[model samples]
Target: MKRVWGSFFLAMSEAIVPLERIHSLIVVLRGQRVILDRDLADLYGVTTKRLNEQVKRNRRKFPEDFMLQLTGEEKDKVVANCDHLRNLRFSPVSPYAFTEHGTVQAANVLNSDAACDMSVQVVRAFVALRHMMINHKALSVKLAELDARIGMHDEQIGEIVKTIRQLAAPEGPRHRRKIGFHPGNR
Candidate 1:
């Protein structure tokens, strides 16, 4: 029975936030990929208010790179992009956007078993996202190179086609005097 209960708990915790779900929660804000305070709080099984309170108490731990409060425009963009965050569209306060490091720090400050576990998952998700971005950048570079090469080849092919067409065209008529008889000489 102990083994059965342990397995059941494991299943439940694994379902808390799948990697794909965490990926969807990430967004680019202010040129940095971040997760919002509410999303992190949900993953950590805490209220956003509680998370913010804890963060405020440990304010020294978080730095500019770790976290930042969104501006009104930034908040509006987030609300527009994420349907679930529509509630923030009218809120007087702007939500915090946490960087990868801030996320781990938040988990440490919270001191919850679930928060600690979710922190690891969040890191993994962030790492995966970074790798994917790098791969996409490489692919973009390769595509640009291919397009440049094709452009050069197009010019060469056009010259070849023009030359072929000139060669295939028939020559103009040629006139020659009679070899043996000429009326003027007679």
Candidate 2:
């Protein structure tokens, strides 16, 4: 059993892909992060038509959040926005976009060695993205705190400069008026 598990892990490792490659394939649509059907198909080592057919057959497995069909307008907008997806403009049917859950479900429907291996990789990619986002939020908070500290120092420096300027200015001589002297002796 240990050997079996080890081999299983080895297979999964063999399928592991670079985070950058998977990250590039991810796109945000309607505020949801998703991977296009064509891209998923490529990862699964199957034709796009075959993959869509499987999804249609296992429609019950996919909920709204799992898989969503792009509307004509949305599809057009995606095509316009992404130069790499330009071919979609000519296709009659817009490709389905699969969220993280949907992507894993797709692998189950595919039920192939390559599908299973790549599915694990896909999940890892999504997790990595989430981790990075969390780190970014923490960094943003730290930067905001540093900015506030610097602002406070600036105010202190400004007050010090004002005091220095006042001390440096020469004091003019005081002129005292004679109270009882009104002599016009030129």
Candidate 3:
């Protein structure tokens, strides 16, 4: 029995999503990286309608933060941005966007071996993106620090140059012109 279940799971997990494909499916919306329901359903080996039905049945599992219904404008933008999502442009119902947590919850709600395996892939994809963002953030911070240091040095150097120029100047008694017309012998 164990061997049979193990083999079944292995077979189900055979259809793996390429890491790049998964990464492409993740989009930033409302300041959160999320996968659209259609894309996620395709990855999980289910119809979009079926996936939505499950989400509706287990409504409590998905909160506003985890899943969101896209606005018409946002939907239009998504469709325009992704060539593969052109079909969605004609879809009357706006698609749902699932965050990382929502993806895991969806897998659980789906209760299938494929969903389980694919959820892991989804999580890994999100994590890989997060790591990249962190690396970029660190690099930016380092650049800002270097720029500040250079700017401080530049200011100091300018002051030093000004002082040197002042010190190198020749001091002489100044001949001043009288401000008002000086009346001599009239």
Q: What would the per-residue lDDT of candidate 1 be over residues 82-163, giving only the tens digit for each residue?
A: 9989898989988999999999999999998888988999999999999999999999999999999999999999999999
Superposition error at 55 for model 1 (Å): 0.4
lDDT of 3 at 132: 97
Off by over 4 Å in 3: 1-12, 154-186
TM-scores, each model vs. reference? 0.86, 0.81, 0.75
Clashing pairs for predicted structure model 3, backbone only: none
Give the 10-residue window scoring lowest on summed lDDT in candidate 1.
1-10
Per-model CA lDDT versus the true structure: 0.89, 0.85, 0.90
lDDT of 3: 0.90
Residue-level lDDT for 69 in candidate 2: 94
lDDT of 3 by residue, 54-164 (tens): 999999999999999999999999998999898999999999999999999999999999899889999999999999999999999999999999999999999999999
Give lDDT tens digits, candidate 2, residues 1-186: 121221223353265556677788888888888999988887776788989999999999999999999999999988887777889899999899999999999999999988888988898888888899899999999999999999999999999999999999888987867677588933
Candidates 1 and 3, the one with greater lDDT: 3
How many pairs of residues collide in each model?
Answer: 0, 0, 0
Alpha carbon deviation, residue 40, candidate 3 (Å): 0.1
